[model samples]
Target chain A: MVTLKQIRNSVLIALWMMILTFPIMVIKVNTIENIVIWRWMNLLYIGVGTVILSIFWFFLINRRKLEPEERKRSFALKGKIETLKGVLAKPVVQKPLYAALLVIIIIFPFVSSLYQTGIMITALMYVILGLGLNIVVGLGGLLHLGYAAFYAVGAYTYALLHRYLGLSFWVCLPIGALSAMLLGILVGLPVLRLRGDYLAIVTLAFGEIVRILLENLSQYTGGPAGISGIPRPSFFGIKMSLSTAMNYTYFLTFALVLFTIFVVRRLEHSRLGRSWVAMREDEVASEAMGIDITRAKLSSFALGALWAGLAGVFFSAKTTFVNPASFTLWESVIILCVVVLGGIGSIKGVVLGAIVIILLPEYLRAFSQYRMLFFGLILVMMMIFRPGGFIPAKRRVYTFDKAQLEESD
Target chain B: MAAILDASQVTMDFGGLRAVNNADVHIDQGEIVALIGPNGAGKTTFFNVITGVYKPTTGDVRITAPGKETESITGLKPNKITEKGLARTFQNIRLFQNMTVLENVMIGRHCRMKAGIAGAVFRDRKTREEEEQVVADSYAILKKIGLETFVNELAKNLPYGAQRRLEIARAMATEPFLLLLDEPAAGMNPHETRELDEMILKIRATEKISILLIEHDMSLVMSISDRIYVMDYGLLIAEGQPKEVRANPAVIKAYLGEEFNA
Candidate 1:
């Protein structure tokens, strides 16, 4: 029901907007011709557009959004996802669906442009990074702003090893991850006592410190120039074209994303995961519950860093270069956004978050100028209306397969 | 009877103030001990000192797990103390709000379970079996405590009484030889308090776990505690069996006013 008052309010907002833009949008000066013209039609368009938009926003769109129905609906991604999960959770649907999805992804490079596959590989890499950040920020409840420090560590390990010792990507992968894990443990040790705001500050400092070190240590890390001409990972000493290599990286990244999902999912349901959630929930209570919080926290940091490290190596391999410019505070922020834009602690949410945050922007190159504007708008709208991100992570629910009758202790 | 938990001359001085001064508390095998006091009595500080949340400024706490010798738990972290069979709940109900009721209990089994990062990721048969057993054990505890219905519910979503009961269930999951419950019945109604009483008694009978509780509910404390300790102004005013503690002049004076005693 659009009342007269609503229409008046909408018109008043439109008038305010038109007045704000009157100088630039409505008035034109032609000094050379010695003529001044008022673009009354432009003003009319502004008035009509603002009124329509405001009416649509206040009455039509926003009314459905901040209304009383939301709580009953909750922070849900909505009925489509709920219905999708119902349809998808069943083995009859899921198994074949998974197989079909895999087949399509495997054959995607053949059917689609190499550029699309490359973009997908980038997206999948972020999926891995998003899942990694999800562990620290999402599950462990550690706000790690220096997460990319480990990514830098991973990238540097592979790059420097290749540049100096000439180690292969396959050999450098685990070493790169281990180097990050070691750094994670090292980082976790000093920051163990800190919590909340202090922790965020410390981790942020850690990230900057790593970047500065890489920049300043020009002799070792090639300073800002960075190491270039790094080779793509090979499959069993076989030579392949750039196109073939891109597809292979895509396949490899896709497989690893699956592995990360499996490992993280299993971890979430396991004892360590429970303790991590417990620690996240209440540190003092978790301590009283007999969790070695120091060990638990360090484990999460190590695991989260390990994934970031894996992503970093994949990144260095994918780009075939290493530079301080590529790794900045912004890199960490982007990964953080992926986890937050996906529901924190939700695996599928993180995956979707990575895809949306990474892939869509690449395809929308025409509106590339407005990408950050759109990003800011979407984030603001998400934070205001649906703060739980696309898909909120659910707590693990347990059920018994059968009733227990055997009892003698 | 063997004393399962003993804290001697525990004085906690916070800067210029002595929150708890030379307070000694001991709980024996299968005994229900109660610590009662006025609001600023340092009962919680004493509890904290004993549970290793705060190390005492002057004294030491010792716990003897079943089949184990008495060992000093002082200077150890709370997790270490809990591993030694002394588990405590917070007075303010510090449950894992987002975690399910069962997971809340399962966390209690942390010290007992030995799975590492590798075990969690790869999930060998042993790890899987241990996890399943933990789930079963945790559910059994919830069932025993009548929180089975809310087993899958988040800890925050449980009602006031159930939250209190869930605290006890979680503490029990640690398999503590001596369970320290800080105000387990604080917000409970008479009916809920009655159930708590029955639950505590049942826990003692079935699990052979000794209990020490800090409560302001005088009737419940008087009715259930085999022994009682009273504190006032951070001093141990009196300690005895419930009858003796009830009639003690200091206990009465602490509860009533100085004028009433006069």
Candidate 2:
């Protein structure tokens, strides 16, 4: 049933996709040996993958033909995902299911190995960072390319504080957050009059400055060699085994993730959250609507950076190390990717995005080298194909259906 | 009647170009005023100055808020002006497109509501009650604007005419004493334009909110406006009752030359 037109279109699209994904698949660099391995088998995988994708695309086009012209622009993926979301949306089904999920997460470290728990902690930390950046980039619609700087500030707050002032993890946590918030305000103030690319460049500059400062100031920050032998967060000064410590870090991160989710969700639906989104949508119009544009933007930056700081503190404690290497622009990019790839302005999407971006490459270690390549492709694909993202945020709607109440009666 | 809004000797200059000359416009308590001008007549610039988007080079913008003393809002931030019960819509629709229709209106309630991070996170009784009222009031605004069906829909997904209406509804949500509409009927058809005229009158009649609109649609302007101010090339050419302004030779020669007779 394949027509010449369909076959031609499919081949064109498949080949285009192959070309995009092909270069990354072939070039695998072995960092330890400093040599490149041009893998030919990836060509085979691409060949097969493109064939399957073409078939899928063919059917998608056929189905698309039945829809109206404007509607035909989107793929069948939208409808399929919408139905899936609808099924999972009911409180009756979701309440118990989320509770079960909570229980499983609570007991996960108990059953898993220390290695698994360690990576799990890292992934959860990224989730918190992703949410923090989400407030700035997603909801506030400010492109922040310097998120890692705040994270570094948080890490250093703990690292430098404990070294100089003899502070504990519990004591430095709030201090680290406040310090990052101070930096956020400082950054936010100058960028108040800037928007779009100008703001992006400024934030990028800020991140690089923080990292370079940390690296150059060897006496304070330990330069390229980074500080080690930092103590893991003590559980009430109980001298615990390494495995217990891993489990403890996992639980702490898990708790923070839940708290972040709760707080972010609340903030997203509140007056301040509304103002942030409004500002993002149209600053002039938002100002005319009586939203204090300066306060809203600053609060978003400050609050967004606070989460990153908390995550930063959590990260250093979990790894028992602090360094400039970890807070690179690439780290900021990945966190931005998590927010963008998940769905900007969506709490659930950010969490899922963090896990996918952090955990997927871990599961497929062979493709670890190609992680950034895949991320770039995923971001491009998401922007073009599904701009709403993997699990697009459901519009928060207040139900005033008195009919439903009466129907229950 | 005391003017709700008063802008006197307003002049705006951008570098070497003078966008608005020494102009004076006032909205008295409960009046529908029109600011009509040709393209680049500096109508929007004048609006911008009044809304605090620009600091007039040598003019004063003042508002006499209900139960509050008169305050000069010249060079004040646009948010500050809005806080003083002045809200405006754009010539180009500037809605929160990614957000829901209801949410767009709720943003108008932002300055009116008081809730910070603590209230948002904790949802205390007062915050909870306020949140409920926001929803109720926003929904009511939507219902009044005939956008109840599209309350949950994204603002981007709305029809063009409906999007324009949503902007008005959002402006109304701010509970302003004076609502400014800049080219509200620019892209709308005649039927939509007629509907907008009715809605403008409804707003004035029901809410007791004075309005100032800049428009090219003379029919909509002449029909609804109690008073009219005509501008041409940054100059306020004429001002009087609609008929008086419409008949003025300067305004007729500059703008309404072909259309208005008698």
Candidate 3:
């Protein structure tokens, strides 16, 4: 009930209707200009606009938020049931949904022929990273600002392997993943005892350190100039090199997306996932309940790193370039924003956030020079208005009667 | 009576103060023993030291079970102590407020559940079977404690008396041979206290689990505990059956007060 998707669709329809009818307004404006003098119409228009603006502003400012809103009440009941059953059922019902979504995703770019295909691929990558981070951040409740470090490590590993060893992309992928995980564990050891903000700040420092090393090690990483002309992957020796476009890359992206989804889905339903949540919720109690906090946190960090590394492999392959610029703190922040803007532990919400965060800016290209400003303002407004998320994780409700029990007690 | 737990020359100092000093305690099998003391008498401090929250500056606490299972509980973590047939409730109730009553009890069974992450995540046949057994056993404990209905309710949402019972229920779920109850009747009214007295007696008789209770309610303590130990200024002043300890001059002076003796 009152889903964000429905709201988006409705808003799109309203905007379209306004645009379609704009010509009629243009004709009326011309007729009015002819009927009145040009100077007087301009003055009249300004005066009328001021009055309309004032009135609209007054209503908006003075509007009373009704105590018992009908829309909210209608949604609340629906929301409770959905959260209890639908959200809980996600892991259980993933198969059919995954199959349907897989078919749609595989063919989506061909059907739309839109630049949004790129956005989808990017979102899918972020979803993979978020799932990994969910293990570290959401489950373990550890703040990891250096997740991009793992991504960079993965990208570099793939680049080096392909460049020097002439290793196949298939062979290098697992190597990249392992490299990232090893780095994750290395980062984890020093800060395993830290908690909350301290852990975050340390990780943030680690990320910066990695970036600086990549920049300073000019001979190894090619420094600020970066590594270029990385090989494009071929499926059965058929590369998309002749197409002058991104056909093979798209398929590669789709396969990666499927793989990410499968891994994340399995991990979420795993015991490690529960342990992370348990640690996050109550560390002392979790320990008392026989869950090992240290192992849980490390596992979360490593899993998160593994996902980032995998994404980096694809990201480097798609771009055919590795640079310090691509793995900046801002990239980490944007990925974090995508996770946060989607609900942190919520898979669907994160995916939706990634799509919107990426596509909304692209769609605003008609605004030309103001595109970035408009995008920034939209992000601010969305955060202010719906901090829980555009699509918040459904909250579970439980009800049980205890009158007889009280009497007995 | 065979001693299940023996504390020898236990002494704990906190910066400038001696919380528990030169203390000796022996808890025999199949007996309910009460550790009674005045407000500043350090009964809780002794319990904490024994439970390994604070390692005693000098002392050894030994728990000897059947088959010569002897565990020196000193310097071990609270959970470790709990694992060795000793579970404790806090002086100020420390139930996980957000968790359901059933879940809180299930947490006690955490140590018992042999299924690791793989088993739980997959809900494999063994995990499912273990979960079923835990649920069944937890329900039985809840029923025994008369909190079966409030099983799904959040622990914090329960009425005060019920919350106290839930605390006991949670400790029982740990399957401890010796339950350390910190002020079980602390805030209860007369009726609730009476009910608790009967409940403690019933647990003693049926479960055959010895109880070590720290209580301020003298009436309940005198009526239930097979033996009582009174403390003042971190020293054991008196120890015996209720009537003898009640009449002891030192206990009267330290805890009961001169007015009660008069």
Q: Give lDDT per model, in order.
A: 0.89, 0.88, 0.75
Selected candidate, larger TM-score, 1 vs 2:
1
Identify the candidate with maximal TM-score.
1
Instruction: Sum up the clashes in candidate 3.
Output: 1
Distance from true position, residue A362, model 1, in Å?
A: 1.5
Candidate 1 lDDT by residue in tens digits, B1-262 = 4578888898999999999989888888989999999998999988888878888899878777788887888889999888888888889999999999989999998889998878998899999999988888988888888888887899999999989888988998898889998998888899988888898899999999899999999889999999999999889999999899988988888888776344
What does candidate 1's lDDT look like per residue over A1-409, in tens digits? 4568888999999999899999999789999998888998998999999999878666544445555566336536565666787998899998999899889888888888988888889899999999998988899999989888999999999999999999999999999999999999998999978998899999999999999999999999899999998889989989999999998898889999999999999999888898889999999999999998998899999999999899889989999999998789999999999999989999989999999899767866779799778778878777665678888899877765554523411
Please give the RMSD of candidate 2 to the true structure: 5.0
Q: On residues B66-98, what C-alpha lDDT tens digit does candidate 3 reach at each position?
A: 556676888987667777778777787777675
Ranking 1 against 3 by lDDT, winner: 1
DockQ scores of all models, one per candidate: 0.70, 0.60, 0.19
Ten residues in sequence with the least summed lDDT for candidate 3 chain A:
A59-68
Assess chain B of each prediction and give its TM-score.
0.97, 0.96, 0.95
Query: DockQ of candidate 2?
Result: 0.60
Compute the lDDT for candidate 1.
0.89
Q: Which parts of model 2 have CA positions greater than 4 angstroms off? A: A1-86, A367-383, A401-409, B256-262
In the predicted model 3, the residue pairs found to clash are: A139-A276
Q: What does candidate 2's lDDT look like per residue over A1-409, in tens digits?
A: 3477777777777677767877798888999999999887887788677877777767655655565544434546666766787888888989998999989998889998888899889899999999999999989999999999999999988988888887888898899999999999998998867899999999999999999999999998899888886778888999999998888888888888989999999998888888888899888888888988889999999999999889988888888899999999999999998998898888889899999889877876778788768766766767766688777777787787775324323
- Ranking according to DockQ, highest score first: 1, 2, 3
- Quote the positional error of residue B62 for candidate 2 in Å: 2.3
